[model samples]
Target: MRAPYASDPATARGRRVPEDESSFRSCFQRDRDRIIHASAFRRLKHKTQVFVEHEGDYYRTRLTHSIEVAQVARTISGALHLNAELTEAVALAHDLGHPPFGHTGEDALEKMMAPYGGFDHNAQAIKIVTSLERHYAGFDGLNLTWETLEGIAKHNGPVTGDLPHALADYNALHDLELDTHASAEAQVAALSDDIAYNNHDLHDGLRAGLFSEDEIAALPMVGPAYAEVDRVHPGLDSYRRRHEALRRVFGVMVSDVIETSRALLDDAGATSVADIRHVGRPVIRFSDPVWAELREIRQFLFTRMYRAPSVMKIRAEVTEVVEELFVLFLGRPDLLPKHWARAVSAAGGDKLLLARMVSDYIAGMTDRFALQEHARLIGDG
Candidate 1:
């Protein structure tokens, strides 16, 4: 029942380690299940999206953000007659490699690991699935369908130039067509990420008291949505007013993506999944007007919330933790966990390889774990 251009699991480029097809599940379904059960997926529950994990119970974690993205992706994919399951799979796995404390943690890791094939979460996600997840007896990683790996590797777009070393190494072993775009489902997942984060961050930022309703009232689409909600529900409680307005904003984004993508799909005349890859531009996107409005909303959030003094204070503290931990592990590789220690030892005193292993260990840590590790190792606990 898939649309002509939908990624059909029946003809999926099979896993690296070949195996018999599942009797009950499509390849994408199996991919989703495997991702759900991964150790990295479980770690997401305590990983920060914007707010630190210990900041509040209400803020979204990487786990919840991934779920929200999956929901948005499924909705858009279903509307477009695309493979919703594959879209969901990609969405769920999209943030698997984000370090603790949101982008702050990633920034620290990237800086610390700059000498050793710099850290990119997208590339780290591919590394996690293709080599880090050692579960199955026959394979070290999930051995996901080729499409799933491609989506994880290139969901944003093509990797046409110098690549993250992790991605480049894996691409050498099993080509992910680094020069081309991922499937349409991946494009949906990527856009869904945008819709979910922008909307939810606005909600979280408001709830955190980083900005007031009046402050955001001058922003683009968000301002109009808030005004409309207030007009419809005069004197509504602050909570409900905020909820109504944000939900409208979310709906606007979804509607824009669906409407714009539908037109693009029709125009492209792409009758198969391969046709999507060669379209040379993403078919999933918001209209120009909506995209500009979203940019304004993002600017508002950036000034009022993301870079707010309160948040940046914590960002500085967490960045210090990541940097110290990287130095600690690099200086004393034996301090890493047993398996990580073995890998460091296997590196045979190659400082660069050992640094990369330390990067992997730290990048895998949850916010709480990273903080605790920093304390325990650096004598602040």
Candidate 2:
């Protein structure tokens, strides 16, 4: 008989993953459904991947960003003969833990949560998927398929630390050899995140009139990337061209992922996407030369797009606003809505004490909800 789960060329493009005959679901489709039903996933509608609330009609929020990442991942998966379902799953749920107001909010929360567990969005993503999201499985959460969970666990595990306080510290994540040999499908999602944000941040900045296309085009890899788009769609010339330009960037990134994964799979004679990791080669991410170019692009975003005076002004205001809210809740117990005050007071611990209370309050917030609470306390709501 043919090897189990073997690819059939006929079902190649739009194949659903084989579930039991009674309940047909592909691996990626399962991921997508579980994510859609998860509380954290729904909250992404309000979280900031980049721009703040109500900034622009076209600027991407976290939900839109996740959808776009899925698109990029699926494109690569289709071309490379990898499982599209797995790619879509990875793309949809990647940013479930990001907070509002973007990095400024993340930093503010990190400072407060540091004594308990310094906040990192990647770590938080895993936490949300594994422990936090509730379901009736008596299993704590959605119990996503093992394959998807493994990728989420490794997606951005520390370059150094794998020491979850409860786990035996003996096994560092990098050394503990989990199957990080993600399908080209999964790898493309991670790379797609880089492509999506880098291009879109440029678009957002350009839209805000913070920078010009020519100026962004002068930056390292963006110069070539945007130029390729200009050439690809010669007739589209509105500032809206950024949208089409971004489409080309995704095309380039996906093409490379497909090419890299195919070469690795072909050389190893692997029977499936899961098996090609003969020696853990890096695939789907940028190759060495392009990686360095990406680093320069990241650096440019950090120095200019991120640090531009207008951006900094908004960041500062957001920081001050969140800080005041943090202080109010932690200092005067009565200021919190009665439930939180009772919840924190009943716990009676010094460790994460106030910060956990703060985290609970903040995590429960929608963008508008948080601001209204802030305004209410400040007498501005």
lDDT of 1: 0.92
**Compared with the true structure, what per-residue lDDT tens digits does model 2 show for residues 137-237?**
45555656655654554543213443332121212322323444554455667877877787677777777777777776787666676777778778676
- Provide TM-scores for the models: 0.98, 0.79
Q: After best superposition, candidate 2 residue 7: deviation in angstroms?
A: 12
Q: Which residues of candidate 2, in runs, are more than 4 Å off?
A: 1-22, 135-139, 157-184, 220-236, 267-278, 331-346, 379-381
User: Distance (Å) between predicted and true CA of 116, model 1?
Assistant: 1.0
Candidate 1: count of backbone clashes, pairs at least 3 residues apart or interchain: 0
Best by TM-score: 1
Q: Estimate the TM-score for candidate 2.
A: 0.79
lDDT of each: 0.92, 0.63
Which 10-residue window of candidate 2 scores lowest in summed lDDT?
Answer: 165-174
Instruction: Write model 1 residue lDDT over 1-381, tens digit each, in one string.
Output: 678999998889999999999899999999999999999999999998888899999999999999999999999999999999899999999999898888999999999988888999999999999989998899988899999999999999998777888899999999999888899999999999999999999889988999898887788887889899989999999899989999999999999999999999999999999999999999999999999998988888888888999998999999999999999889899898887756876899999898888888998999999988888889663
